[model samples]
Target: MWLPLLVKRLNQVDMQKKGLQLTAEEIYDINNASLKDAIVQFGGFCTGEFISKEGLLLTNHHCGYDAIAARSTPQADYLTNGFWAASRDKELSNPGLFVDILVRMEDVTGKVLEGINAQTPEAERAKLVSERMKALAAEAKGPENYVTYVRDFFAGNEFYLFVYERYNDVRLVGTPPNAIGKFGGDTDNWMWPRQTGDFSMFRVYADANNKPAAYSPNNKPYQPKKHLPINIGGVEEGDFSMVFGFPGRTQRFMTSEGLKLAVETSNPARVKLRGKRLEILKADMDKSDAVRLKYASEYASVSNYWKYFQGQNAGVKRMKTVEGKVENEAKYNQWASADANRKAMYGNVLADINKGYADQKEYTLSQVYLGEAALAPAAAKFALNFVPLQKALKENKADDIKKATDAIKEASKEYFEGFNVPTDEKLFAAMYQMYYNDVPKSQHPDIFKTVETKYKGNWNKFAAEAYKKTFLTSPEKLNAFLAKPSLKTLENDLIFKTVNSVYNNYLTNINPKLQAARSSMDKATRLYIAGLREMQSDKVFYPDANSTLRLSYGSVKDYEPRDGVHYSYYTTAQGILEKEDPKDEEFIVPQKLIDLIKAKDFGRYADKNGELPVNFITDNDITGGNSGSPVINGRGELIGLAFDGNWEAMSGDLVYDKDYKRCINVDARYVLFVIDKFAGAGHLVNEMTLVTTPSPNASTASTSAEAAKADVLENVKPAVDSKTKVKIKKEERKAKAKMKK
Candidate 1:
């Protein structure tokens, strides 16, 4: 191999610090069209580094974990301790995860510009392009959905089309159990001193035909052309670095209004909703050891963000509204004063974007709620039966009776598990009391009197009747009375439409009103965008990551917490002991791990600081999408896997705090320690051609089988597959748009 095992590739040096932020393509030497195939999206994840011949595909650990977690059984712990197959036969399969390979690039610029161009109105353009892109995607037939994107540039003046191939050859290879993977749990999720290894391993399986195929025992791992070698020299301040992964989400660039709303109402509402869900999550997780283990990731995932929102909300609250008049007057005066700037395509900029922002605001805010309150809350109902059904439909109310009966009959079959009787009874009683207390009797005289006369303010009796009326009611009585099967089926159903209906009603009515304030703010966003464009155009700032593949760089730096707050830069074998509090669930260390800590045999895996630690913290700017990303140095050497940021940096969800926000990564050294020292698997370690000559006196005894994986950026090369070259011969354009200077 031309690439050495340890030495940083000379070509991979810090290109940016040499005053080269622009790619050769930008200077017109490299055609953007030629690179189209290299840019692709997978499971909403953007991908790069086409032709991964190294058989080693790099993505976020969280990206692979979902697949592994889906296949995980209680008997085999995968996420915490780590997974190493004795051979290929033991590899687990999952559907959701896939390593997308960008195979070809197609520049359909002319086709894209056929009906829409600089002259096209943004509204009409959106409509035309939406249909056009779908049509383009439809005309495609292949192993994967062909990704097509319309790139708008130079203030939306230019547009281009990018197409890519997605590979479904992903398989779980190895992973540490939850203990090491999710060390800090919810408490340390978004904060620094972050100790977590949010990484999962998977191998890409290419079919016998050497293309993506359905899962099979016969499939082989798709080797990539290049796999990053490990570099544990440890990143220091001012060192060049880059990250490559499927970052899930980022809100870096937004209308100041959108940012405000995020930092304010939207984030808070989500936090409140999640807070409620967590309360239940905590209870359920606490009660059962199996469920706790089974749903560890789900719980920690939410907790990570619960802290994020708390910090985000704090950032939002800390930002007091400035004087609108003064701010606007100054902004307007500045814009008006810049005659030269206004003359350059400024005439129609305002009116041109007037409706688009209006069109995109709700959708922008809608993005925030898609998973949390909207889906997660629904998933949380332990069983369908737990759904709080409305009290018996009145005999006189035929519509209500039929509605209730129909819902129960539908849910009774295959939908709900048995209702949680105790939880339901207690919850419904509290809910009924809360409802009765909040609304006036005068508003609903009939119902109020019924509530008063029968239940007589006794929440228990009221709740019991409602619970019985829905799922608990005997089928014989229920069928006789309401044209339905015995509702006994609902006793097992955890989901209830009654609860869903109420929740939807609240989301529908309350959200629209709340959304208007956000919409109004989105309209004023032009001012913000314009202000930002003016301010930061000189810096090489990419669009706030949209769960796309991006590179964020910073160095290892530790901070002094509040006077009494305790923290360390590289947690040691000792951190395991510091976290030995028995009462605190977050601090529970396994006995074996505690023993390891007590023994203090870090071996060669220990940093010069001498500790084969479990996890380490850093200040790299990372977020959801950045999860499982390989933290690399300026030489593009892998150092650690960015798993979580510190709690203080949780505020980084919306705002990137250079000072306080740090990317929490599972140090390469620790990852190696766990693999070698704890697992004692030498086979996996022997696979990697050892590249590094660590200090002979260093702690090799503590070093684990994962040492080969540590600082893994140098020598690994993926096996390459030769395929047909994508052919796109551009025809000369006569009715073409003029190229901008």
Candidate 2:
């Protein structure tokens, strides 16, 4: 349902019919400042949009969760007590956090595929394409600081070149406390009727010339080419909505066998492994706030996907997605057999895919267990860092040894900061045992034999002894070894040996098989997709998301999750109060918010019913990296922030269920209310251009108090002075005049 921006121009007429006000050029013109200029790939994972010329950005609270948690501590406790920087100078800097603004994207498919034909071998074709792409990227990346890369689309059937300007000086502006930002916690995650105010604010800083720069005290806020005007007007049920962002990935083209493997083998294994890890982490976290602070981000991340896999399995079953894929494949086969040319190209595609998946099944599951279980413990994963160090030591290369040692020393500081030995030991015991029991005996690592013979098959006992003997769990010991620089010391370490053996076995035995199977599947899939496009020539084929900028347009709507229950399109503050629990941490509401709700201190942000809108649902197609994407109305104004999809559509990445695929967004009104009234960060609001037109859903109200409030709001001075407003209008007119020519 999501189309790459390149294809948006082709669908411009169709999009206009759906109520889009802006032209395709207006949305993505490289020559003039357009809507794309306002958007950024936040921290290389989520999406964010510029809300002010001074580079004030808006993204989901969860999207900024890790950066916020990293800065939090028991004393400052920014996580519990929200952060608000009253001025630019007061903002906190986040090292290594950066945002990339896409400068432009151009199709380079013909150039990339040059000199490669059907006669070319798969490996040779791939090599040629890689060489061409590298050359094209180098040419595109001139003397500027722009980062250029080529990404394949439609499963290598096409490619596009993306140019981005990355700014490393992004700062946290403001965020509501977890009680507000993560109000429902995991319980309400991916669920409907959510009241979580999930928005967070940040500001991008740059050098004096408004170019990307590293964090510096003297750096000023960036002046973006375009910023979205915030529309406070509430949405109606049927109003046009569009979500634009970098949607991470989707496997809509995945074969039935792939779906079966995911649902039955990979997902369940990951769920079980992460579930155990979470149990241990939560136990320790609950016992102490310090532990919770240390592991909060990790817990959130693990639990998010743990729940996602569960929902995805259930949704896949409920939607009968695998059966549907099988039915589609049957049709594809029938279509392919009708013509000799098609049969020659695609006759083997499905058979190859089925055999490839079957061949890789056990190896894929083994790899999953190897990753999720064998490397589940922080200590085991941390030990991987010393692999290069060991190799350098063996080679007797002092420069490589010194470089590796310095890197480990720096890495150990961060690792030890969050590493809890007791918790990691438990994780090691549980996860290793899971891997040993689940994986076949033939595939077992050499260390499992040691555990069975030396430790009498007692994983806990082996783990305790391993933790005691290994330097990985102790920074002091690690540093001591680094100072001494002994290959024998590292090679003999039990944890290092265990991690190395697991990796070595996989590298020697499993990876080659998996890669070979995957290569066959990849080639078949590319041909299958190309054939499908040819067969269904009348249908518009949108490529699956690959972390590229995309646009999905739809309308605000509601749905029935089941036979008798119909859900509303939007949630309100009243739902927040209804869900609040005095004892439960997840549902606890701040007394300030509770009092404000009870007092009905709703400002101009209130909807027609005099209730504060919390979150709304749209049919916009989205996926993982679409988090914090701006939900824009037909007029091209920011209406909300897209955060999560409905639970009934958890398998959306594999199959988009039109009826159940609802995009959950925190209402822009709620975001503003929390920022302006709750956090007292009106200056951030003043930075944005506020659109106050009444919504289509607004109804006449005759209350005297309402009239008084409206009058006061109208009389308030605009953020921009009258002269500046006139100047802006004149500049806008000049740009339009130039566009006309």
Q: What is the C-alpha RMSD of each candidate to the true structure, in Å?
A: 13.9, 9.4
Q: Which window of 10 residues has the lowest lDDT sum in candidate 1?
A: 732-741
Highest lDDT scorer: 2
Model 1 residue 176 CA deviation in Å: 2.2
Model 2 regions more than 4 Å off: 1-4, 696-741
Q: Per-residue lDDT for 1-741 in model 1, tens only?
A: 001111122222344553223342321112233222222233454232222332444344555555555555557656544677667777777665565544433444466558664466655765775677566555653445665454432223223344444566566666666666656556555555444545545566777655667777888776543455565554333344444555566554443444555555567656765566567656865786555555555655666667677876665454332233236535644674577665353433333333444444444334344344333432223223233333443233557656666775665432223223444355455443444453333222233355577668676775566566553434444355345422354432323433444345446644565456444443234444554466456743344444434445445566544442334445455545655555666555667666776787656666554556445555666667555666655444556676666655555555566656666667666766665666664455544433353322234422653243332311221111111111112221111111111
* lDDT computed for candidate 2: 0.87
C-alpha RMSD of candidate 2: 9.4
Give the runs in model 1 whose Cα sits over 4 Å from its true position.
1-69, 72-83, 103-122, 135-164, 233-238, 316-333, 336-541, 560-569, 613-619, 693-741
lDDT of 2 at 660: 88
